[model samples]
Target: MSAPAAPASRADWPEIRTGIAADVHAFAVDDPGPLRLADLDWAGAPRLSGHSDGDAALHAICDALLSAAGLGDMGEHFGVDRPEHAGRRSADFLAATLRMVRDAGWSVMHVAVQVVTRRPRIAPRRREAEARLTELVGAPVSFAATTTDGLGALGEGDGLLAQAVATLVRPGDPARPA
Candidate 1:
């Protein structure tokens, strides 16, 4: 075979200061009762249980973004016992998260989320879910789904789990080396 191409140097990469955060959230369906999975928006899908809409995906995403910006977590900002957030929607959470991140001098660059569930197959509506989340966050959002292969509670179809990673960047910050 011909010689392999050399890897690009660090200088070749874009000059930007970026931060990353990841979070995971899992809830048993029986804990909080039947609540909707906001992203899926499918009527037949098994609902999650939580104080809000219980969209694990959105909640995880918000947590990740907040963590990345050193802004604490979802529970601290929107506590379970807070009556004001009793029946809030995941979309509202997302909006508030974006605003908080912006106020902290960071902008969301990208978001990726993976949800694990055994019901209402995600492939059919994956695109719709991604688009909706993107609109809410004003950033590109990627969505994925998986099953536990009958291994654990998720595998046994008891609940859903979601994990998210967020990339944030601070622009025009002199502290960041160009």
Candidate 2:
């Protein structure tokens, strides 16, 4: 038989999208807190300053998910001006974002997040963080951390930063094997 006919168009393949995002928050000098990051509570570390719990990692992940789904960023969905979001948990943000992504007819394939911080070391807790995030998002989640090598405000340990990338695909798409 002759060579199989070339796919009629790109539409023959399932749609896939990727998104990248980042977030940063400075330590809260006024608020003494049980620091929350990657959905875990750090008893001794100081908390980050923000209207929410200041879990930069989760916030970045939410933004990435929203971006991938073409649903806009976190600010539009949960703005500081919204009094209800004040002091909200980043986990709540994550759950809401996941819901939004699902409602958009897309499912998360995976997510990778990198945290930039000088203190409250991440290696010791990477596995735990990954497990928790994976459970929350219903997808594979990777968590990693790095330092700025003493270059800026982040290097000074004044704040925490996080970056995330997410992949999404339509559920049950022919291109996606069960």
- Please list the C-alpha lDDT of all candidates, in the order they appear: 0.75, 0.91
- RMSD vs true structure, all candidates: 5.4, 4.2
Q: What is the C-alpha lDDT profile of model 2 across 1-178, one tens digit per residue?
A: 7998855555555678999999999988678887899899976579989999999999999999999999999999999999999999999999999999999999899999999989789998999999999998899999999999988999998988999999999734445443
Candidate 1: stretches off by over 4 Å: 1-35, 38-40, 175-178
Q: What TM-score number comes out for model 1?
A: 0.80
> Against the true structure, whose TM-score is highest?
2
lDDT winner among the candidates?
A: 2
Candidate 1 lDDT, 11-68, residue by residue in tens? 3433333334443334444453454553545655545667887788889888888888
Model 2 scores a C-alpha lDDT of 0.91
- TM-score per candidate, in order? 0.80, 0.90
